[model samples]
Target: MTTGPGAGTTVELVKLTKAYGATVAVNAIDLRIAAGSYCCLLGPSGCGKTSTLRMIAGHEDVSTGDLLIGDRVVNDEPPAARGTAMMFQSYALFPHLDCVDNVAFSLKMKGVPVEERRRKAREMLDLVDMGKYAARLPAQLSGGQQQRVALARALITRPGVLLLDEPLSALDPFLRDRMREELKRLHRELGITFIHVTHSQTEAMALADLVVVMNQGRIEQAGPPRELFNRPHTAFVARFIGGHNVIRSADGLRAVRADRVQLGGGDLRTDGTVRALEYHGTSVHLSLDVAGADDFAVIVDEARFYDAPLAIGAPVQIGWNHADAHPLAS
Candidate 1:
């Protein structure tokens, strides 16, 4: 991959840490994000995902360790000097300024001519599909439109890396999904590294090429979403990433995808009482209470499940193949 200015740059954190006196926000962590890759720092609040992203954006001080963008160490550099742009969860568009002006604010700070900056701003708005709203203020536009303007503002700088701190958390579910596609398309077109910090596992699974799962200020696991979902390294990862049922088997702790757990098939068998059944449009989620396991779940196809539906508290037999079980660390 190419390195340096204007190109997607490799981001490396060597034992990076952040602390507030005795309290450590981010434990010493090592991560190397490939150039032009979409990487997501995923974890619940207080897991230090935001702190790590802020440190990379040069918005926060690194308590210790090296912060490298491309081949250059950028620990002490200012935010603007780090070749990174940050988009906050709030979108932070200038309410008073029109969309075009909001996007051109960065260039205006650099003393660019009004006509030239506005022209550049319009181009950015066009890229984000917000050109038609360029003349409107933040209040006049919708939530998604405001977000697009914010994105255009961040991109106007043409940085090597884009650091987003929960960019879609503020949008409605439908808008969030639409914006996700927009973000992915933008990343492909721009070919720049995108380091997004989000707590939503669904978002990470949908968007990230690499997902870094953090817990208690440290990385629990880091890999492709499928690897983390299919083969979790630890119990925390299995539970945090969702969709899987972690259980203590005779052999050891293992995790099976809810979809993989069969209601009444395969050689391996176990008996459980139907604790709850949820009817989703495409699939049915069944919560079961096995003899030894806590709350086991199986995702059944909507049509198949309805064909022979079981009632709550109904005794049911469940089975899964040995190959479907993925062992987990305690």
Candidate 2:
């Protein structure tokens, strides 16, 4: 692709806020995204992930503070001038246009010569492996194919930062996994910053080099996926990231990974009745009805679970090492 001005630019949000009358969507949040890195703004619905992304994309106005892209404060810039391209959740390709034309639409609007625009569009299509279907309309392509076209269209601008707002949410589980790899490959090949908004913890963990977990218009934690998983700063992050059971201990609330819990071994032990069991192929998730912790759970290997096979309603002892417990802020 063509590396235009602002390519591989670092994005810095200093005390950024987005407010709508009485409702504050994105509170004063400060964040720095490194150039050529993959960052995921992760949170549940209404957590302001999308709002933050739109503000960075210049689709929404920043209510307070500065939004700097490579040292230039772009708070007053238009969407096209922000050096960012957004691929919408719905893959908003024009239905009347074919894949190539859709990918070349932006250039067409800029009054580029027809032949040159088409040639550049074809290159982007080939980059996304959608060149073979260049003549196909949106109706003729599958969800994954349409998404690829949208991606090419977004990248055609040679944006420094590619903003994806739930780009893979429309695909099936299998297709999502495949496209996740595609996104990672594209980010590496292009060598530009990528900011993806997602609600799926697994998706963020799989794709992002930096994961920012937001909750109630504030960032709960921001770090590498492994760090967030292993040492979550708050109860919301510990629970939302999954696999962790938050328990009220003698000192304070603590978080423990489900995989660290042993059936009948460890330094700390507790008796609980198995309330539910979920078969995951490689492992089994056991939900227990402990006295103080209502949502206590454990993950056991498939082989070990099948060997003993504790049934629902069976009383069992679950324990973990004291060092495995991570303290939570609240």
Best by lDDT, which number? Answer: 2
Residue 293, model 2, lDDT = 85
Across 88-193, the per-residue lDDT of candidate 2 in tens digits comes to 9998899999999999999999999999999999999999999999999999999999999999999999888999999999999999999999999988888889
lDDT of 1 at 51: 95
Off by over 4 Å in 1: 1-6
- Highest TM-score model number: 2
| Per-residue lDDT value at 65 in model 1 | 92
The estimated TM-scores of all candidates read 0.95, 0.97
Least accurate stretch of 10 residues (summed lDDT) in model 2? 1-10
lDDT at position 120, candidate 1: 94
